[model samples]
Target: MGRRILLTCGEPAGVGPELAVKALGCGVDFAWIGDPRHLPAGTPVAQITAPDAQVPPGHLPVIRHDFAADATPGQPNPVNAQGVIDVIARAVDLVGRGDFAAMTTAPINKQALKEGAGFAFPGHTEFLAHLAGNVAVAMMLASTNVSPACRVVPATIHIPLEQVPAALSDEVLEQAIRITHAALIRDFGVAAPRIAVAGLNPHAGEGGTMGRQEADRMRPLLDRLRAQGLDITGPLPADTMFHAPARAGWDAAVCAYHDQALIPIKTLDFAGGVNVTLGLPFVRTSPDHGTALDIAGQGRADPESTIAALRMARDMAALRA
Candidate 1:
């Protein structure tokens, strides 16, 4: 399977199937990994025994991970939660074996997964990391649609805002920076990546007048990494990082928390942002948004993010290949 992407059906009761249907004819080679019955009515679906097999034009090539219940638009079925989790695991297994170049997962509802399948992870990035044998990973949100394309990674995610300071240790920041740097070089084709790390406080602790994490902890760590020949900058003020000129200064920005990273990117390119997991053995990406249960099957769900995700997977896979 040359440059093939395995697209997982996330919350099937939501918009995953519709996105899968729309993702076709986008010039990306991919196969949907989910039960075809969950797809929208009248969708032309063809089941292939193996991932490498081809499907006719205008037909979705499904790998057929069966779900326990029929999907109802806008209402998640807890009984089908196990199937969603299993589908993700199956995609990781298949992609990890190198049969597919990369994997593009649709959005999944964490609450639903937790209630239905007793899921324990915060979100897809963490879950995927566990499936990949507990490898260290960084979650990057990328929007190639924007000029001076924005890529961001949060060192601490899915935690309370008040808990961020304690969570952001020297080790966590270093790991996030290094993983993001490596991904830029390997998957993003940046030979020498320039990374910008955001501050955890207001005005980056205002030169230690506000908080000392910047000068006391962060600066020393960044200095050590820079000495090792990495092009890294900041503890910069988060408010000043996303402007066009500012963004042009760095290849990627490593923020202190989830909102710090996500707010700007989502604000910049809400419709086309792709969630990428860096430092995994294989390439993995998903829509930056979540399962849109409010508008699951009304055909109002925008497929731009899903489409961008698939294309990005193909491009990244090609680079890796």
Candidate 2:
């Protein structure tokens, strides 16, 4: 018996509920947090009255948070937006109190939340940071099954491409790298983690030919981290860093922006990738993809990523414990 983890069934209008139901069949030990009524009529679910409630085979253990209105598959209602937000807040509060080992969230529909609940933050990553006392958090996507299983952190996330140049700095890069390094050692159980950083420019700025960020910002930061006895590499060329031979050289790669990190992971293991939020007081993970509204109620949603998230959360929790 492992620790009971709390799971959030993200956007009801999307595939989150279906994927959650599907995840139960995958043998991950956890309880789902959402409304029982929202689950498709035929799904086997048991209401969880206690943290350690028994869940029968083929049945999902659920802690119900009744939504304002019933969710219609493939049709997001702003009326249920507040309820969606509340479920996440509940999971965070529970994890913070040690009521659960860790939390693995499903994909949320940000626009629906904003339209329905007046949600303030950009997305789950920022909202989670706000709830966790405004801590600095870095997003890392990881996969263990892929060859050269890689973990990546994007230095500048969710910012406009034009603004990336100004958004990326010595301070920002240092923060992302430091948080990632510590998380690898603590949560991932890597004794001496090797981190490779990607440059913002092509061919790692080719000695100032493509960009100066490598020479001016990243190089100095890497030097500082090296002096601190951290096994850090790069300002490497992003193009060459993700291949098998290159990936074998590092435990994780910190990239200059979002796509630089995500493209490779998604390409390698889109269905199994887990999005981990590093530097949080508690462990938090989510499916690496978003709500697939097109296939919302068709039972076509693949729960592989969610299952991977739950398994990853469990592994990370055990390491931390």
TM-score of each model, paired residue for residue: 0.98, 0.98
Candidate 1 accuracy as lDDT: 0.93
lDDT of 2 at 27: 62
Poorly placed runs, candidate 1 (over 4 Å): none
lDDT of 2 by residue, 140-254 (tens): 9998678788899998899888999999988899999999999999999999999999999999999999988889888988998899999988889999999989999999999
Q: What is the C-alpha lDDT of each candidate?
A: 0.93, 0.90
**Ten contiguous residues minimizing lDDT sum, candidate 2:** 1-10
- Candidate 2 backbone collisions, by pair: none
lDDT of 1 by residue, 46-126 (tens): 898777887788898889988999999889999999999999999998998887889999999899999998999999999
- Number of the predicted model whose TM-score against the real structure is largest: 1
